[model samples]
Target: MTNSPDILSNTFPDTPQRRLLLDFVADEADALQRGEQGGFWPDNHHLISPLIGKAGKFLDEDEHVAFFHHLLRLDHCPPVKTEEDFALLLRAYDGLGDLMSRGYPVCSLPFHLAVFLFGGDALARLPAEPEPTLASFQSGVSFLRYARSFAHMPGIMSKRQKFIDLSADRALVARVRKTLLHGHQQLLDGLGRLWLWAFVFLVLQVEEEAQPVIRKIREDAAAAGDVKRVETLERFIAAAGLAR
Candidate 1:
């Protein structure tokens, strides 16, 4: 993954916060290396569990962005392989999300893209049997939404577009459509509308099978008093000529 020089330079200006984040990244990298040498995998939750709150206490916006970028880069050298490795990646993604929720401008697009890619790979590698748990499916959908938010960014948009196109494959689309249609009511209440909107926007081709789902999402948004989201969904539906 190429780093944006402008983002790097702006994020790493000579500041106390910059030094602190850099030091933290260096320490985590060293720890990971040592753990690998000893044939021991570090628990991601144990590693970053405390820093969830501390990151907010110490890092400002630019520092937060720099910290996440450096930590994410660690996975590049030795790509995540095992379930434990993926858990570590998810922990890092969660840490970044925590910072962003606290008003820190942690450019989380890359991390979201990483999560989407890794999550899909993990799913594909799973043994065929009972379906993936709702929690797992929800997690994948959540990352996709985050990546979608940055679809206008350079390079990132193309990757997201690729994922969107792949997701439109007939078998996968049919499976996801069935899952969404028959999913638990509580799960639908929590993430269904957003997932529905994303699926409709990204994968579906405004065909007859897609119209009812689109209408349901629009109704859900309106009922929730999200006029802006409702309007956006309406525009997408109309633009796709899915609306009657």
Candidate 2:
């Protein structure tokens, strides 16, 4: 999770974009060294804090990094507190978003993650989504402004089903909600699971496919008599508005 040059070089193969990302990461790490930024924190991922040194690039690699690492394959990042912090993180993600689109052109998770991180209202107030502020990104991200983005990248196309649930992501959320539950569950970290869960319940807001999966997990917990787990699931379901 540390922002060592090694992690950057190893993550990106392209020398050009790699340099851009490395520079961005270095700036972020330096920002962390300077001081704290300010803002309201969301309950989810409202958890990470400023680190001591060049650690993990700025913030530690938390459960959220799992998705960024495994799917986009670099697999990592975190949230911000103030407008400055939000802009700093947003700038890095902009590099990530553009870096990711170097080959492909239509991915939107970078923009979506930005909105999710800064809160929809903050993004809404902007003149426009500053997502790929890079000139190379010809396509502005889909913000639900036009359509949903499937991310149409490696994880979905990996040969071995690298991320089982993620491998099912065919760039279509509805299709994902329809088919993802059928895939066998694997070792997604807590945030990974939370992201996938939220992807279904919150984004699609449909109960058809999500209900069965929720039932299966709840059933498994009940069968094992894991009272804590069952309670946790109920609380999550209720809070996420998963249950009707």
Could you tell me the TM-score of candidate 1?
Answer: 0.35
Best by TM-score: 1
Candidate 2 local lDDT, 1-244, one digit each (tens): 2343443334335453334344344443333234321121122122222231122343334312321322221233432333433344444443343333322222223323333333222213222223322221212222222223334222222212222343243333433333333322321112233334444333224445457656765665566666765564565555545544
Judged by lDDT, which candidate is best? 1
- Candidate 1 on 94-207: residue-level lDDT in tens? 444333222212331332233233332222322232343334444555545553465332333234455456555554444444433432232134342343445445434526
The segments of candidate 2 whose C-alpha lies over 4 angstroms from its true place after superposition are: 1-71, 76-173, 176-182, 187-193, 223-225, 236-244
How high is the CA lDDT of each candidate model?
0.42, 0.35
Clashes of 1: 0
